[model samples]
Target: MTRVRSLTAALSAALLLLSAAACGSDGDDTPKSVAPKTAALGTLTPGVIKVAVQPYSPYTSVQGDKIVGLDGDILHHVAKKLGLKVEPQVTDFAGMLAGVQSRRVDITIGGVAWSADRQKQGLFTDPPYYSPPAMAVRSGKTYKTVDDLKGLDLGTVEGYVWVKSIQAVPGAKLHAYPDANGVFDDLGAGRVDVGFLDPLIIIAAQKERPDLKISTQYLTPPTAAEVKAKPAYQYFQPYQTGFYLPKQATKLERAISTEIDAMYANGELTELVEKYGGDPEQFLRPDDAAAAARRGVDRPSDWTPPAIAK
Candidate 1:
């Protein structure tokens, strides 16, 4: 019943995006003023946002011609506020990374982890949520800590935030795949002893194969890592999920951040997340480690996230 409700809401959101996409603006390269308002974003196209997306559900997914997910729901409200049309293009992970860099698309979505290395590729929007990476192992196996993974074969998607940390694990063999499906497939087939991936993807995989014996465990790394120089490694933290825009799209980044802030302030973001099968408290709010990861990023010295009610 919950799944059906989520699907129903997702379809409704997708319809809203489709309607917005249909309402193209006249010859003007600015935010469109369809009804209520048009944001003053320095968009590449006039009143239209060409977005790149990979089909990662609960984040973003290709449902027919429209994109739907938690990210998509946020985008729907954001577009309505700014009076902009959404044009989403479906592509693989590489295309999502490259499309925004080349300015071929105004932005890209679908569970892009916030990282310093990837930020060098393009501008990343403020995160709407943060999710922990998962350690997928055979059911009943007691592998909880990083030390437990020694000498075992592990698989993860290419460009995942934990790749560096996983590689740093002594005696652990890392196999990088192009996408999440391949990682789980290999894990189920015993090609790899473990699968290191996003927890949501792990949930989806488990649903697909209920008979498969697998368990989801959150990643735990040491407080400080002298081995890896990265901040995520130093803290052993989860990544903030955000969007990638063209390198010079600072104004656009700020504009989008403002809308995200509004949603957070009014609890819209949390409600939307919860309705989509996400745990708002777990994934939406940043814990101590994630706060450390945030400080490591290039935000203003005085920067702070929306205050959660105690």
Candidate 2:
């Protein structure tokens, strides 16, 4: 009986050991150690993330020689999370887009608006923020509605969607310029009666030229009846600003998108936006289903990356 009891005790001990091993612990009820969470580094060049930034203040700007602003801060956060260093390349908006297309830079984050034309050229990560298009006119000009600007000259950046909106107005003269400075210059000089542009741009322009006044209302898409009546007019859409990535860099784009989604959830993106003079609530996209639906479609078939200049 004594021998049998001793054998039974040994068997119980063995079962306990097996149970502990299966549970990944020493029978002491201690929790198992978990591996630390690490960010997925996808298709990024080793050690460095080259960023092309347009000198758009509040979004991105050059202070002395260093890049700074909302997009700059966000880029730094993303690079840190990915364990990469940032190499900023400041240029005009067109140049920044070209740099991303040509692979001269890994990505760009200078408040680029998400447009169908841009989607055809490359990939834009889910929009991190949004801003509506606004109009800037001389202080003395009293315009209450988009239609009021008819018969007056309107200025806007060449590639911006504002061009289409201005074109839609009957009798309105549209003057497209290469950059914001040129457009604002014409507006200030009375060459153009109105400057339809980004709200942030309008804000900056107001600071520079106190004589300039921003409209109280933003331009919106026209009603169905208006669209039918004025088929030529393309109404202004809100800017869903996002990071631009190369066409071949799908993995990188996904990685960045994931980070952006997390940032929005955790309020980090809002913090950055507020830090750079933007309305956090207005810009943040916590639920962007439409953007997700359009994520990976519409790449340009005939597009080729530009050759990097030596």
Among the numbered candidates, top lDDT falls to 1
Clashes of each: 2, 0
Evaluated against the true structure, the overall lDDT of model 2 is 0.62
User: How many times do residue backbones clash in model 1?
Assistant: 2
Whole-model lDDT per candidate: 0.68, 0.62
lDDT computed for candidate 1: 0.68
Candidate 1 residue lDDT tens string, 1-60: 001124344444444444444564345644345433343466766577778776778678
Q: Distance from true position, residue 225, model 2, in Å? A: 4.8
State the weakest 10-residue window (summed lDDT) of model 1.
1-10
TM-score of 2: 0.68
The per-residue C-alpha lDDT of model 1 at residue 112 equals 74
User: Tens digit of lDDT per residue, candidate 2, span 1-310?
Assistant: 0001243443444344334324532324221332122223443444556666656776688675356877777777776676665666555555566666756567888777666767777888766666654677777667756578779998877756667777888899999887788987777677988887766666666766676443423554455566577754434444467789888878778677777767877778777766654556455632232344354554344422111112
The root-mean-square deviation over C-alpha atoms between each candidate and the true structure, in angstroms, is: 8.3, 21.4
